[model samples]
Target: MPAFDLPRRLVAEALGTCLLVATVVGSGVMADTLTDDTALALLGNTLATGAILVVLITVFGPMSGAHFNPAVSLVFALKRDLPRRDLGFYVAAQIAGGIAGTMAAHLMFDLPVIEVSLKARTGGSQWFSEWVATFGLVGVILAGLRFDGKAIPWLVGLYITAAYWFTASTSFANPAVALARSLTNTFSGIRPLDLPGFVIAELLGALCALALMGWLLRQPANNTYSAARHS
Candidate 1:
Protein backbone atom coordinates (compact mmCIF):
# COMPACT_ATOMS: atom_id res chain seq x y z
CA MET A 1 0.00 0.00 0.00
CA PRO A 2 1.07 3.58 -0.60
CA ALA A 3 2.24 5.64 2.34
CA PHE A 4 -0.02 8.61 1.60
CA ASP A 5 -3.80 8.57 1.58
CA LEU A 6 -5.83 9.22 -1.57
CA PRO A 7 -6.90 12.74 -0.57
CA ARG A 8 -3.37 13.85 0.22
CA ARG A 9 -2.05 12.44 -3.00
CA LEU A 10 -4.82 14.13 -4.91
CA VAL A 11 -3.96 17.46 -3.36
CA ALA A 12 -0.31 17.10 -4.25
CA GLU A 13 -1.19 16.22 -7.83
CA ALA A 14 -3.55 19.18 -8.06
CA LEU A 15 -1.16 21.67 -6.55
CA GLY A 16 1.77 20.47 -8.59
CA THR A 17 -0.22 20.58 -11.81
CA CYS A 18 -1.57 24.02 -10.96
CA LEU A 19 1.91 25.35 -10.39
CA LEU A 20 3.23 23.69 -13.53
CA VAL A 21 0.58 25.04 -15.87
CA ALA A 22 0.87 28.43 -14.21
CA THR A 23 4.55 28.40 -15.05
CA VAL A 24 3.91 27.44 -18.66
CA VAL A 25 1.14 29.95 -19.31
CA GLY A 26 2.56 32.78 -17.22
CA SER A 27 5.96 32.45 -18.78
CA GLY A 28 4.46 32.42 -22.23
CA VAL A 29 2.43 35.52 -21.51
CA MET A 30 5.42 37.34 -20.09
CA ALA A 31 7.63 36.21 -22.90
CA ASP A 32 5.16 37.40 -25.50
CA THR A 33 5.04 40.75 -23.78
CA LEU A 34 8.80 41.09 -23.65
CA THR A 35 9.70 40.20 -27.21
CA ASP A 36 8.46 40.25 -30.77
CA ASP A 37 10.73 37.36 -31.64
CA THR A 38 8.95 34.02 -31.45
CA ALA A 39 12.14 32.08 -30.82
CA LEU A 40 13.08 34.29 -27.89
CA ALA A 41 9.61 34.03 -26.41
CA LEU A 42 9.71 30.25 -26.75
CA LEU A 43 13.13 30.16 -25.12
CA GLY A 44 11.84 32.04 -22.11
CA ASN A 45 8.78 29.82 -21.86
CA THR A 46 10.88 26.69 -22.17
CA LEU A 47 13.32 27.72 -19.44
CA ALA A 48 10.61 28.70 -16.95
CA THR A 49 8.66 25.47 -17.53
CA GLY A 50 11.73 23.25 -17.31
CA ALA A 51 12.93 24.94 -14.12
CA ILE A 52 9.51 24.60 -12.48
CA LEU A 53 9.19 20.92 -13.43
CA VAL A 54 12.42 20.19 -11.59
CA VAL A 55 11.24 22.09 -8.51
CA LEU A 56 7.71 20.66 -8.51
CA ILE A 57 8.83 17.10 -9.03
CA THR A 58 11.49 17.35 -6.35
CA VAL A 59 8.99 18.73 -3.87
CA PHE A 60 5.90 16.62 -4.63
CA GLY A 61 7.25 13.40 -6.15
CA PRO A 62 7.56 11.59 -2.83
CA MET A 63 3.92 12.31 -2.00
CA SER A 64 2.14 11.68 -5.29
CA GLY A 65 4.83 10.86 -7.83
CA ALA A 66 4.38 14.39 -9.14
CA HIS A 67 2.28 13.26 -12.06
CA PHE A 68 0.95 16.60 -13.17
CA ASN A 69 -0.02 15.16 -16.51
CA PRO A 70 -3.03 12.88 -16.88
CA ALA A 71 -1.14 10.81 -19.44
CA VAL A 72 1.59 10.12 -16.92
CA SER A 73 -0.98 9.14 -14.30
CA LEU A 74 -2.64 6.81 -16.78
CA VAL A 75 0.68 5.16 -17.49
CA PHE A 76 1.28 4.55 -13.78
CA ALA A 77 -2.24 3.19 -13.41
CA LEU A 78 -1.62 0.77 -16.26
CA LYS A 79 1.65 -0.33 -14.63
CA ARG A 80 -0.39 -0.96 -11.42
CA ASP A 81 1.74 1.42 -9.43
CA LEU A 82 -1.31 3.65 -9.03
CA PRO A 83 -4.62 2.17 -7.93
CA ARG A 84 -7.17 1.71 -10.68
CA ARG A 85 -9.90 3.03 -8.39
CA ASP A 86 -7.97 6.25 -7.84
CA LEU A 87 -7.35 6.99 -11.51
CA GLY A 88 -10.48 9.07 -11.91
CA PHE A 89 -9.63 11.28 -8.96
CA TYR A 90 -6.10 11.87 -10.17
CA VAL A 91 -7.27 12.78 -13.66
CA ALA A 92 -9.96 15.09 -12.29
CA ALA A 93 -7.44 16.88 -10.10
CA GLN A 94 -5.02 17.29 -12.98
CA ILE A 95 -7.63 18.73 -15.33
CA ALA A 96 -9.09 21.02 -12.68
CA GLY A 97 -5.67 22.17 -11.60
CA GLY A 98 -4.72 22.85 -15.19
CA ILE A 99 -7.75 25.06 -15.73
CA ALA A 100 -7.10 26.86 -12.47
CA GLY A 101 -3.52 27.44 -13.50
CA THR A 102 -4.59 29.01 -16.77
CA MET A 103 -7.02 31.21 -14.87
CA ALA A 104 -4.29 32.18 -12.46
CA ALA A 105 -2.04 33.17 -15.33
CA HIS A 106 -4.78 35.34 -16.79
CA LEU A 107 -5.36 36.95 -13.43
CA MET A 108 -1.68 37.65 -13.00
CA PHE A 109 -1.57 39.41 -16.36
CA ASP A 110 -4.80 41.34 -15.75
CA LEU A 111 -6.57 39.54 -18.59
CA PRO A 112 -10.13 38.22 -18.53
CA VAL A 113 -10.81 35.19 -16.39
CA ILE A 114 -11.53 33.05 -19.42
CA GLU A 115 -10.66 33.33 -23.08
CA VAL A 116 -10.93 30.77 -25.84
CA SER A 117 -7.67 30.46 -27.66
CA LEU A 118 -7.50 31.48 -31.30
CA LYS A 119 -4.15 29.94 -31.95
CA ALA A 120 -4.57 27.12 -34.45
CA ARG A 121 -2.08 24.29 -34.00
CA THR A 122 -3.06 21.59 -36.44
CA GLY A 123 -1.32 19.68 -39.20
CA GLY A 124 0.12 16.27 -39.94
CA SER A 125 3.52 17.37 -38.76
CA GLN A 126 2.08 18.82 -35.57
CA TRP A 127 0.14 15.67 -34.72
CA PHE A 128 3.13 13.49 -35.49
CA SER A 129 5.29 15.74 -33.38
CA GLU A 130 2.95 15.34 -30.41
CA TRP A 131 3.14 11.59 -30.85
CA VAL A 132 6.92 11.65 -30.89
CA ALA A 133 7.11 14.05 -27.97
CA THR A 134 4.81 12.05 -25.75
CA PHE A 135 6.46 8.77 -26.70
CA GLY A 136 9.85 10.14 -25.78
CA LEU A 137 8.52 11.64 -22.54
CA VAL A 138 7.02 8.38 -21.31
CA GLY A 139 9.96 6.36 -22.54
CA VAL A 140 12.32 8.63 -20.63
CA ILE A 141 10.26 8.33 -17.46
CA LEU A 142 10.09 4.55 -17.60
CA ALA A 143 13.77 4.15 -18.43
CA GLY A 144 14.81 6.70 -15.84
CA LEU A 145 12.75 4.95 -13.18
CA ARG A 146 14.69 1.76 -13.90
CA PHE A 147 18.17 3.23 -14.30
CA ASP A 148 18.49 6.42 -12.24
CA GLY A 149 15.41 7.26 -10.22
CA LYS A 150 17.11 10.15 -8.46
CA ALA A 151 17.73 12.04 -11.68
CA ILE A 152 14.17 11.73 -13.08
CA PRO A 153 13.28 15.31 -12.23
CA TRP A 154 16.20 16.75 -14.14
CA LEU A 155 15.78 14.28 -16.94
CA VAL A 156 12.13 15.13 -17.40
CA GLY A 157 12.72 18.86 -17.09
CA LEU A 158 15.54 18.89 -19.60
CA TYR A 159 13.73 16.56 -21.99
CA ILE A 160 10.73 18.87 -22.04
CA THR A 161 12.94 21.88 -22.65
CA ALA A 162 14.48 20.18 -25.65
CA ALA A 163 11.17 18.86 -26.92
CA TYR A 164 9.76 22.38 -26.91
CA TRP A 165 12.11 23.28 -29.71
CA PHE A 166 12.31 19.97 -31.51
CA THR A 167 8.61 19.23 -31.71
CA ALA A 168 6.43 21.22 -34.04
CA SER A 169 3.64 21.65 -31.50
CA THR A 170 6.10 22.87 -28.87
CA SER A 171 5.64 19.60 -26.99
CA PHE A 172 2.37 19.99 -25.12
CA ALA A 173 2.69 16.33 -24.21
CA ASN A 174 0.15 16.51 -21.39
CA PRO A 175 -3.54 16.21 -22.23
CA ALA A 176 -4.58 18.45 -19.36
CA VAL A 177 -2.08 21.08 -20.32
CA ALA A 178 -3.23 20.99 -23.91
CA LEU A 179 -6.84 21.44 -22.84
CA ALA A 180 -6.06 24.25 -20.41
CA ARG A 181 -3.86 25.98 -22.92
CA SER A 182 -6.79 26.03 -25.31
CA LEU A 183 -8.47 28.41 -22.91
CA THR A 184 -5.83 31.07 -23.25
CA ASN A 185 -5.18 33.10 -26.38
CA THR A 186 -1.50 33.45 -25.58
CA PHE A 187 1.83 32.36 -26.89
CA SER A 188 1.42 28.82 -25.67
CA GLY A 189 -2.26 28.41 -26.41
CA ILE A 190 -3.83 26.10 -28.99
CA ARG A 191 -7.27 26.43 -30.52
CA PRO A 192 -10.00 24.41 -28.86
CA LEU A 193 -10.72 22.77 -32.18
CA ASP A 194 -7.12 21.71 -32.47
CA LEU A 195 -6.92 20.18 -29.03
CA PRO A 196 -8.57 16.82 -29.76
CA GLY A 197 -5.91 15.77 -32.22
CA PHE A 198 -3.13 16.64 -29.84
CA VAL A 199 -4.84 14.85 -26.94
CA ILE A 200 -5.43 11.71 -28.99
CA ALA A 201 -1.90 11.68 -30.27
CA GLU A 202 -0.50 12.09 -26.78
CA LEU A 203 -2.61 9.29 -25.34
CA LEU A 204 -1.67 6.95 -28.13
CA GLY A 205 1.95 7.82 -27.75
CA ALA A 206 1.94 7.12 -24.02
CA LEU A 207 0.14 3.82 -24.53
CA CYS A 208 2.62 2.75 -27.15
CA ALA A 209 5.52 3.53 -24.87
CA LEU A 210 4.01 1.52 -22.04
CA ALA A 211 3.52 -1.45 -24.32
CA LEU A 212 7.02 -1.17 -25.73
CA MET A 213 8.64 -0.77 -22.34
CA GLY A 214 6.73 -3.70 -20.92
CA TRP A 215 8.16 -5.92 -23.63
CA LEU A 216 11.63 -4.48 -23.40
CA LEU A 217 11.83 -4.76 -19.63
CA ARG A 218 10.70 -8.34 -19.45
CA GLN A 219 13.15 -10.75 -17.83
CA PRO A 220 15.12 -13.05 -20.04
CA ALA A 221 14.32 -16.77 -19.95
CA ASN A 222 16.43 -18.82 -17.59
CA ASN A 223 18.91 -21.21 -19.19
CA THR A 224 18.52 -24.70 -17.76
CA TYR A 225 21.92 -25.85 -19.05
CA SER A 226 23.71 -22.88 -17.55
CA ALA A 227 21.91 -23.34 -14.21
CA ALA A 228 22.84 -27.07 -14.12
CA ARG A 229 26.45 -26.30 -14.97
CA HIS A 230 26.63 -23.67 -12.20
CA SER A 231 25.09 -26.10 -9.69
Candidate 2:
Protein backbone atom coordinates (compact mmCIF):
# COMPACT_ATOMS: atom_id res chain seq x y z
CA MET A 1 0.00 0.00 0.00
CA PRO A 2 2.68 2.48 1.02
CA ALA A 3 4.73 2.03 -2.08
CA PHE A 4 8.23 3.46 -2.28
CA ASP A 5 11.67 2.32 -3.35
CA LEU A 6 14.62 1.96 -0.98
CA PRO A 7 16.17 5.21 -2.19
CA ARG A 8 13.00 7.14 -1.49
CA ARG A 9 12.59 5.42 1.84
CA LEU A 10 16.17 6.24 2.87
CA VAL A 11 15.72 9.86 1.90
CA ALA A 12 12.55 10.09 3.89
CA GLU A 13 14.24 8.59 6.92
CA ALA A 14 17.08 11.10 6.73
CA LEU A 15 14.80 14.08 6.20
CA GLY A 16 12.42 13.05 8.96
CA THR A 17 15.25 12.48 11.43
CA CYS A 18 16.76 15.85 10.58
CA LEU A 19 13.51 17.68 11.20
CA LEU A 20 12.80 15.72 14.35
CA VAL A 21 16.15 16.64 15.93
CA ALA A 22 15.83 20.22 14.78
CA THR A 23 12.46 20.43 16.48
CA VAL A 24 13.93 18.97 19.64
CA VAL A 25 17.10 21.10 19.93
CA GLY A 26 15.45 24.24 18.63
CA SER A 27 12.55 23.99 21.05
CA GLY A 28 14.87 23.36 23.97
CA VAL A 29 17.00 26.39 23.16
CA MET A 30 13.94 28.60 22.76
CA ALA A 31 12.28 27.32 25.89
CA ASP A 32 15.39 27.85 27.98
CA THR A 33 15.72 31.39 26.65
CA LEU A 34 12.07 32.19 27.36
CA THR A 35 11.86 30.75 30.84
CA ASP A 36 14.22 30.43 33.78
CA ASP A 37 12.01 27.74 35.32
CA THR A 38 13.41 24.32 34.44
CA ALA A 39 9.98 22.73 34.52
CA LEU A 40 8.55 25.32 32.16
CA ALA A 41 11.45 24.94 29.78
CA LEU A 42 11.06 21.16 29.77
CA LEU A 43 7.33 21.55 29.28
CA GLY A 44 7.83 23.63 26.17
CA ASN A 45 10.41 21.26 24.83
CA THR A 46 8.15 18.29 25.48
CA LEU A 47 5.16 19.82 23.77
CA ALA A 48 7.12 20.91 20.71
CA THR A 49 8.92 17.59 20.32
CA GLY A 50 5.71 15.63 20.68
CA ALA A 51 3.84 17.88 18.28
CA ILE A 52 6.58 17.62 15.67
CA LEU A 53 6.72 13.84 16.05
CA VAL A 54 3.02 13.51 15.29
CA VAL A 55 3.37 15.65 12.19
CA LEU A 56 6.52 13.99 10.94
CA ILE A 57 5.27 10.48 11.47
CA THR A 58 1.94 11.15 9.82
CA VAL A 59 3.63 12.77 6.83
CA PHE A 60 6.45 10.29 6.40
CA GLY A 61 5.01 7.01 7.64
CA PRO A 62 4.02 5.91 4.17
CA MET A 63 7.29 7.05 2.70
CA SER A 64 9.70 5.30 5.06
CA GLY A 65 7.73 4.02 8.02
CA ALA A 66 8.85 7.29 9.63
CA HIS A 67 11.53 5.68 11.75
CA PHE A 68 13.35 8.77 12.96
CA ASN A 69 14.99 6.84 15.78
CA PRO A 70 17.61 4.18 15.21
CA ALA A 71 16.30 2.29 18.23
CA VAL A 72 12.88 2.05 16.63
CA SER A 73 14.40 0.88 13.37
CA LEU A 74 16.44 -1.70 15.27
CA VAL A 75 13.29 -3.00 16.91
CA PHE A 76 11.57 -3.38 13.55
CA ALA A 77 14.61 -5.08 12.10
CA LEU A 78 14.61 -7.52 15.02
CA LYS A 79 10.92 -8.13 14.35
CA ARG A 80 11.88 -8.81 10.73
CA ASP A 81 9.72 -6.02 9.34
CA LEU A 82 12.95 -4.27 8.29
CA PRO A 83 15.57 -6.05 6.30
CA ARG A 84 18.87 -6.85 7.97
CA ARG A 85 20.77 -5.49 5.02
CA ASP A 86 19.16 -2.07 5.40
CA LEU A 87 19.66 -1.71 9.14
CA GLY A 88 23.20 -0.32 8.95
CA PHE A 89 22.27 2.21 6.31
CA TYR A 90 19.24 3.29 8.27
CA VAL A 91 21.31 3.89 11.40
CA ALA A 92 23.96 5.76 9.44
CA ALA A 93 21.36 8.01 7.84
CA GLN A 94 19.74 8.72 11.19
CA ILE A 95 23.04 9.74 12.82
CA ALA A 96 23.99 11.97 9.91
CA GLY A 97 20.53 13.52 9.87
CA GLY A 98 20.69 14.11 13.59
CA ILE A 99 23.96 16.07 13.29
CA ALA A 100 22.53 18.06 10.42
CA GLY A 101 19.48 18.84 12.50
CA THR A 102 21.64 20.07 15.37
CA MET A 103 23.55 22.28 12.97
CA ALA A 104 20.32 23.74 11.64
CA ALA A 105 19.12 24.46 15.15
CA HIS A 106 22.44 26.07 16.03
CA LEU A 107 22.30 28.25 12.95
CA MET A 108 18.79 29.38 13.81
CA PHE A 109 19.80 30.24 17.36
CA ASP A 110 22.98 32.01 16.18
CA LEU A 111 25.09 29.57 18.19
CA PRO A 112 28.17 27.68 17.11
CA VAL A 113 27.55 24.91 14.61
CA ILE A 114 29.04 22.25 16.87
CA GLU A 115 29.69 22.73 20.53
CA VAL A 116 30.45 19.72 22.68
CA SER A 117 27.98 19.45 25.52
CA LEU A 118 29.49 20.06 28.95
CA LYS A 119 26.27 19.16 30.69
CA ALA A 120 26.96 15.90 32.40
CA ARG A 121 24.19 13.28 32.41
CA THR A 122 25.33 9.96 33.79
CA GLY A 123 25.15 7.47 36.67
CA GLY A 124 22.79 4.65 37.55
CA SER A 125 19.59 6.64 37.70
CA GLN A 126 20.11 8.23 34.30
CA TRP A 127 21.01 4.92 32.70
CA PHE A 128 17.97 3.26 34.21
CA SER A 129 15.73 6.08 33.09
CA GLU A 130 16.91 5.75 29.52
CA TRP A 131 16.20 2.03 29.67
CA VAL A 132 12.66 2.58 30.84
CA ALA A 133 12.01 5.35 28.33
CA THR A 134 13.21 3.35 25.34
CA PHE A 135 11.41 0.25 26.54
CA GLY A 136 8.08 2.02 26.80
CA LEU A 137 8.57 3.67 23.42
CA VAL A 138 9.20 0.40 21.61
CA GLY A 139 6.35 -1.24 23.46
CA VAL A 140 3.95 1.49 22.43
CA ILE A 141 5.08 1.19 18.81
CA LEU A 142 4.64 -2.59 18.71
CA ALA A 143 1.26 -2.46 20.41
CA GLY A 144 0.10 0.26 18.08
CA LEU A 145 0.93 -1.90 15.08
CA ARG A 146 -1.41 -4.56 16.38
CA PHE A 147 -4.30 -2.46 17.70
CA ASP A 148 -4.30 0.92 15.91
CA GLY A 149 -1.74 1.42 13.19
CA LYS A 150 -3.28 4.74 12.23
CA ALA A 151 -2.77 6.15 15.74
CA ILE A 152 0.92 5.30 16.09
CA PRO A 153 2.05 8.86 15.54
CA TRP A 154 -0.18 10.14 18.33
CA LEU A 155 0.71 7.26 20.58
CA VAL A 156 4.45 7.86 20.22
CA GLY A 157 4.05 11.59 20.58
CA LEU A 158 2.07 11.26 23.78
CA TYR A 159 4.43 8.67 25.22
CA ILE A 160 7.51 10.83 24.68
CA THR A 161 5.71 13.82 26.12
CA ALA A 162 5.11 11.93 29.32
CA ALA A 163 8.50 10.27 29.35
CA TYR A 164 10.26 13.61 29.15
CA TRP A 165 8.90 14.58 32.55
CA PHE A 166 8.84 11.19 34.17
CA THR A 167 12.32 10.08 33.18
CA ALA A 168 15.38 11.51 34.89
CA SER A 169 17.27 11.77 31.62
CA THR A 170 14.44 13.65 29.88
CA SER A 171 14.10 10.57 27.72
CA PHE A 172 16.83 10.82 25.15
CA ALA A 173 15.82 7.31 24.16
CA ASN A 174 17.10 7.45 20.62
CA PRO A 175 20.81 6.83 20.08
CA ALA A 176 20.98 9.38 17.29
CA VAL A 177 19.25 11.98 19.45
CA ALA A 178 21.55 11.38 22.40
CA LEU A 179 24.55 11.60 20.13
CA ALA A 180 23.35 14.79 18.46
CA ARG A 181 22.40 16.35 21.76
CA SER A 182 26.01 15.85 22.83
CA LEU A 183 26.98 18.23 20.10
CA THR A 184 24.72 20.90 21.59
CA ASN A 185 25.74 22.50 24.86
CA THR A 186 22.23 23.62 25.67
CA PHE A 187 19.31 22.73 27.89
CA SER A 188 18.71 19.45 26.11
CA GLY A 189 22.32 18.50 25.74
CA ILE A 190 24.19 15.56 27.28
CA ARG A 191 27.92 15.09 27.71
CA PRO A 192 29.59 13.08 24.98
CA LEU A 193 31.43 11.02 27.56
CA ASP A 194 28.12 9.73 28.89
CA LEU A 195 26.89 8.47 25.54
CA PRO A 196 27.95 4.86 25.92
CA GLY A 197 25.88 4.17 29.02
CA PHE A 198 22.77 5.75 27.56
CA VAL A 199 23.15 4.04 24.21
CA ILE A 200 23.75 0.63 25.76
CA ALA A 201 20.77 1.02 28.01
CA GLU A 202 18.62 2.07 25.06
CA LEU A 203 19.68 -0.93 22.98
CA LEU A 204 19.00 -3.26 25.86
CA GLY A 205 15.62 -1.69 26.38
CA ALA A 206 14.66 -2.07 22.72
CA LEU A 207 15.73 -5.70 22.65
CA CYS A 208 13.76 -6.37 25.82
CA ALA A 209 10.68 -4.80 24.27
CA LEU A 210 11.00 -6.94 21.16
CA ALA A 211 11.19 -10.11 23.21
CA LEU A 212 8.35 -9.13 25.49
CA MET A 213 6.10 -7.98 22.68
CA GLY A 214 6.76 -11.18 20.84
CA TRP A 215 5.38 -13.08 23.78
CA LEU A 216 2.60 -10.64 24.57
CA LEU A 217 1.31 -10.69 21.00
CA ARG A 218 1.67 -14.40 20.52
CA GLN A 219 -1.25 -16.33 19.01
CA PRO A 220 -3.57 -18.05 21.43
CA ALA A 221 -3.21 -21.46 19.93
CA ASN A 222 0.19 -21.11 18.34
CA ASN A 223 3.45 -19.29 19.04
CA THR A 224 4.62 -15.90 17.76
CA TYR A 225 6.04 -17.70 14.77
CA SER A 226 2.56 -18.44 13.50
CA ALA A 227 1.50 -14.83 13.82
CA ALA A 228 4.59 -13.63 12.00
CA ARG A 229 4.24 -16.26 9.30
CA HIS A 230 0.68 -15.19 8.59
CA SER A 231 1.40 -11.49 8.74
Using lDDT, give the best candidate's number. 1
TM-score of each: 0.95, 0.94
Poorly placed runs, candidate 2 (over 4 Å): 222-231
lDDT of each: 0.94, 0.93
- Candidate 1, residue 214: the lDDT equals 84
lDDT of 2 at 137: 96
Q: How close is candidate 2 to the true structure, as a TM-score?
A: 0.94
Model 1 TM-score, 2 decimals: 0.95
1-231, model 1: which lDDT tens digit per residue? 349999999999999999999999999999999999999999999999999999999999999999899899999999999999999999999999999999999999999888999999999999999999999999999999988989999999999999999998899999999999999999989999999899999999999999999898776667965787799
**Winning candidate number (TM-score):** 1
